[model samples]
Target: MNEADALDLVQFAIWTVLIASGPAVVVAMVVGVGIALVQALTQVQEITLTFVPKIVAILLTVALSGPFVGSQISSFTTVIFQRVQDGF
Candidate 1:
């Protein structure tokens, strides 16, 4: 493959990774912020308090977004394979 094709593939890979990970990341971030707010208000300085809620939020996000993530990865793979088949 030429440099342009390689660049395009790299860019696509990055975008696909971002798309696949965005939901869980966003949910975790939101949960973390919420937990932080609660901790600030209630003075609960437990480390586990922050971790558990973020983990649960991430898990829930993954469970809900599994199909979407799968489809995106599969589609990216298919495109890559098609490019390979087409000789770059």
Candidate 2:
């Protein structure tokens, strides 16, 4: 409710979002970069080549990370609700 508490809550929410998404995003980015490098080296220059692998890698990462992500989000939600109940 106070300005400082509100700011902290907002910051925590942002961090939670980043933590939740970071693994998948990082995997996609790395896959994209590697695909780009391979294309550059082989002179393939196929745009779809970049997209498909990144998508697949991200999907796999999301699948593998689902439980961890869910737990993080659930914990954050619980903390937020508890704060709300505590009159924050």
Candidate 3:
């Protein structure tokens, strides 16, 4: 592949990775922030309080987004394979 083509592939791969992970990470971050706010307001500064909710939110996000994530990865893989087959 030419340098430009290689760069485009790399950029596409990076974007795909970000897109795949964005939902779960964003959910976890929002949950964490909400939990922190609650703790601040209620004075319930328990460590597990923060960790548990974030973990649960992340897990739920992963579960909910599982199909989307799988499809995105599969599509990226297929594109990669097709490019290879095209002698890229």
Candidate with maximal TM-score: 1
Model 1: per-residue Cα lDDT over 7-46, one tens digit each: 9999999999999999998898889889999999999899
The residue pairs that clash in candidate 1, if any, are none
Report lDDT (Cα) of residue 41, candidate 1: 97
Query: Can you tell me which runs of candidate 1 are displaced by over 4 Å?
Result: none
Q: Note the Cα lDDT for every prediction shown.
A: 0.94, 0.92, 0.91
**Where in model 2 is the C-alpha error above 4 Å?**
none
What TM-score, computed on C-alpha atoms, does each candidate reach?
A: 0.97, 0.95, 0.94
Q: What's the candidate order when arranged by decreasing TM-score?
A: 1, 2, 3
Writing each residue's lDDT as its tens digit, candidate 3 over 7-68 gives 98899899899999999889988998898899899999899998888888888989999999
Report how far residue 42 has shifted in candidate 2, in Å. 0.7
* Tens digits of lDDT, candidate 2, 1-88: 8899989989989999999999998998889889888988999998789888888898899999999999999999999999989987
Model 3 spans > 4 angstroms off: none
